[model samples]
Target: MKVTRLSSKGQIIIPKALRAAHNWEAGQEFTAVDVGDGILLKPKKPFPEKTLAQVAGCLKYRGQPKSLDEIEDAIRQGVMEQWHDRVDTRE
Candidate 1:
């Protein structure tokens, strides 16, 4: 077993060997859960896992398909309406 020391900053440095074994890199996110004896470090997922079949056909569209430009315009309009103070420096 590997040993590690917790720094004064309350941060424990995970050993490089274990990190390499798990393919963990810098900036990896983890959720620390306190078990009875110790804390369990679990990798935090950005989003819930879902298969194509599970998410497909979730939104029904009876009308005709929208053009890419039209969809972009709609998104832009929604953003403008929501964030009135937002600046567009690109323009």
Candidate 2:
């Protein structure tokens, strides 16, 4: 078992051997959880950053895309339907 000491500045230096064994790099983040008996240090998993191109073809749509005017008109029609429904219910 390896031993480590916490500095006065609240910083703990993980032993070189343990760091090498775990393949942990400097500046790596960890989440500390209080386990009642002791603390648990878990390596933070990072989420991959994706661009629009990476997620572009995720949706399968064989139909041609609608024009901007058609899209706006559809939205307006939907909103008017919702507003009419609310007004009708109130009356």
Candidate 3:
């Protein structure tokens, strides 16, 4: 177990060894959880936000894929059926 002292400002300087072991950075955000009498400190996960362009080349859209228009039409057809609208299949 590691030992640490609380400063006058109520801040505890995490030990260098523990920080190095965890690869923690100066500005990295962490969460402290109270486990009964003791506490657990862990780094907060970074958000999984990503742009479509970033994931564009990484995805494999396989099988009989439908176009955007086809998907929209399918959705509209489903909605129409739900509303009991007689679908004019002539189009």
Q: lDDT of all predictions, in order shown? A: 0.90, 0.92, 0.85
Q: Write the per-residue lDDT of candidate 2 for residues 1-91, one digit (tens) a residue.
A: 8778889999999889988988999989999999999899988879665899999989898898989999999999999999999999999
Model 2 ranges off by over 4 Å: 48-91
Best model number under lDDT: 2
lDDT for position 54 in model 1:
92
The whole-model C-alpha lDDT of candidate 1 against the native structure comes to 0.90
lDDT of 2 at 76: 100
Residue 25 accuracy (lDDT) in model 1: 95
TM values, all candidates: 0.53, 0.51, 0.51
Q: Return whichever of 1 and 2 wins on TM-score.
A: 1
Clashes found in each candidate (C-alpha, N, C closer than 3 A): 0, 0, 0
Error of 2 at 17 (Å): 1.1
Task: Supply the TM-score for candidate 3.
Answer: 0.51
Which of candidates 2 and 3 reaches a greater TM-score? Answer: 3
What does candidate 1 score in Cα RMSD to the true structure? 13.1
Q: RMSD, model 3, all Cα superposed?
A: 14.6
Can you tell me which runs of candidate 3 are displaced by over 4 Å? Answer: 48-60, 64-91
